[model samples]
Target: MLKTFRWAFAVTGLGLVAGVLYDGWTALGLVAVLAVLEVSLSFDNAVINAGILKKLNAFWQRIFLTVGILIAVFGMRLLFPVVIVSVTARLSPPQAVHLALTDKARYQELVTDAHPSIAAFGGMFLLMIFLDFVLEDRETKWLGPVERPLARLGRIDMLSVCVALGVLLVTATTFAVHAHQHGGGHADKAQTVLVSGIAGLITYLIVSGLSDFFERRLADEEAGGHAGQHSEDAGTGRPAVALAGRAAFFTFLYLEVLDASFSFDGVIGAFAITNDIVLMALGLGIGAMYVRSLTVYLVRQGTLDDYVYLEHGAHYAIGALALILLVSIRYEINDIVTGLIGVAFISASFSSSVRHNRAARR
Candidate 1:
């Protein structure tokens, strides 16, 4: 475990030293708190990431560690907020960057202004993931009672989509009525949430559909070339490996989108601590690196196989997060509460798995 986290520790040490030098002990403490907050909020994200990472080939795995980390750290944590502020505030990206540096309070305000839409998009996307997982027929059942019933419902055409759309409609209607009651204030917020939610759903469909298409093509090609060849590398049965170059590309894209969906809440919650973008980026970047490292470690250690219910717990946590994100659009939930929900689910699942293992041994 120490070996796996050696780099994370090193990075944290350097960040703390830099933080202390830059702004004295307070900055150092803030960075430490932010990093810990990010890690706690994102532990389930690492588990889900590990589940996906196990399916990719070696080269793609390396890309996830290298290129993917870059995206998670810089692209999402730093550039993403800038892009959001720029687009929403009608400023250029460079101008947004300037604002972030020179006028952080205002920059934080702009980002907060955009949170309704961000929450809508991210929440819907994550909701679809959880719904699809629950609704799918799986050979291995973790929470069989809940899952079996959901799988039965999955037999209905587009049931997951239907459920998501219904929830979105209710959310929009509720908010729209609320805004109207408040003298038509924030009337546009409902529209923004609806549009953003649809956009997220569309993005998920397109990415997952493209990935499936490419994966099928690759499987066909492999079958034609080599008889008795498996689509996945010989291992514990997950989904078939997406082996074709194009398929791998799409799969990587899907993974990035998935990660982004998981990040929306954490990014917004960080604002409660401080409005300094530089500090937020640096602290969150350190946490993101540790999450990525944890993903790799989980995959390499076959932790998912050992803790069979862990992935199920993570997915359920995603479900909880999706709902929480949507609700947070109107009602404020403490970040600590959000983090605890994930932790609680994961803890319960881990405990259940241990009991199962013990019973099997007996």
Candidate 2:
């Protein structure tokens, strides 16, 4: 615990120093606020992640803590917003970069205006996650008539890819039609939406597919081992090798997917606070540290096992966030409120977990 606190403080202190150097006191304040927001909002994510982490091998665990940080800091904080600006705002990559750096004020306005689309992306993604979880839980025979066929349609992994692609096509067409009806240039809008949506979808598909592949492989290995003890021992050596390979791949994919999911909100929300690229980066980067530390804390504390319902609560929060993101496409939802909802659910779960522990002890 002492070591963990030291690490958290060290990383936070580093972020503070970086913010001060990059954008001074104002940036520092923004970072502080972002840190608080991230801590509050990401408890649900931590809970969900804890459940996943328990299933992962030790090697993957280390990668999640280390490489995951890089993805959050660089991929989400720096690259993601640039991609959004280039695609939706019709800014060239270089121009967007310049706008973010030089015309920070106007850039913020542009990004804020782009919130609807960002929210749409997050909402749909979360909806997919929620739906998948629901399908996994319900054990009804009637649904199997419909689900078995879909399940046989090459796994949920493949289904997700198809859904993501379909969404990209639909979103691009809708945006293009809207642009044309509004007397704006439809070609640019169509191209931008198509390209960006495809890019995001492809990233999601690749990461999710890879993660599923590894998880399935691990399960297969375990199942095969239980079938024949003699063969299992002989196969044990091979299984260990296979397990290590799969774990490494899964860890990389998990971090990438998680970072992408988190970015859907973090990048959009950052615009609400500041548009200065440096300030936005500083603020969100600090927030990322807290999220990462929280992930580690969940792992170390075995929070999921201690609180059986915690994962369920986190998934519920994820479902809510997804709905909120979808609504934000047409409406404005404050980031503070989003954060609070997640925090409230997590707090309730924690209280429940404490009661459970006490009851078990008695």
Candidate 3:
């Protein structure tokens, strides 16, 4: 209660101070706005995370909040953009850094210009999520036998890799064919886009797949240990440990993936706001904290279970995010607009969930 509030404030304060020191008042304001937008847009994400978190053991929960923070802050915030700049923009590593730091204005323009591709990535990604959800909802008999197979294949996590690859291929071909039309001096631009897209997809696949495998293995071990202890207890009267370790591990992994997915839009969007790398990082980092805290709050409150349609809303948001990303490949999407769209859908779902709960009570 008080302790948690204190901790949250302390963490936020630290982030603000750091942001101010790094980039001053303008940076701080950006951080504040981004934080609000992220939190609002990701309420559904928090609800979904809460449902998963309930299944995890306490140990893994702590790891998720701590280590997961590091990954989000450093990995997604710093490294992700650099990778994008190098791979997509054809800037050498050093040159990219220089552009981000010194030529902040131009760098931001470049990032904004890249939104169509980002939107494309997200749009395709969300489509897979939406399709999978549609197939899984037994109550709504949409696809039947065909639905089941596609549902099985389109498990959002698994299908994301293929979608990403597809996006890369399409982007590569489009860039190659349109290069001359765009005033084609840089022959390597198409190659860079192709390579970067492939790299991003590969990175997503490896990280997500390995995380899933490790979680499954941990779960199996925990199950076996529980069973062994149960048998021993029957003969020797020993208490058995719970077999939920693996579940927790997997939940953590899922949360990480979710975080990564959410951050992609933020990182790209932040660039549109400011090219000052430090400012962009500070602003987005603050936004990350709000999203993280909101996620924890949703878990603590049992928001997902209490609001049944919340998960549905989140999946829907995922669908929208996918669409937004796809569109971004060709247009500049304002973060405010993106955040509002997700928030609106989630809010509607939440209201529906509340109504259903009341009806159930009656």
| Candidate that would win on lDDT | 1
lDDT of 2: 0.65
Q: Candidate 1 residues 283-349, lDDT tens each? A: 8878887998898899989999998899999999999999998887778889999999999999999
The candidate that achieves the highest TM-score relative to the unseen native structure: 1
Using TM-score as the measure, what is the rank order of every candidate, best first?
1, 2, 3
RMSD of each: 4.4, 5.4, 5.3
| lDDT over C-alpha atoms for residue 332 of model 3 | 56
Candidate 3 whole-model C-alpha lDDT, 0 to 1: 0.63
Q: Rate the local accuracy (lDDT) of all candidates.
A: 0.85, 0.65, 0.63
lDDT (10s digit) by residue, model 3, range 84-148: 66766788988888888888776666665554445444444445546546556355322256546
Q: What local lDDT does model 1 show for residue 202? A: 95
Question: How would the candidate models be sorted by lDDT, starting from the highest?
Answer: 1, 2, 3
lDDT of 2 by residue, 223-325 (tens): 7667754223253455445664775676567666765675677677766666667666666766676666677677888766677657656766887886666
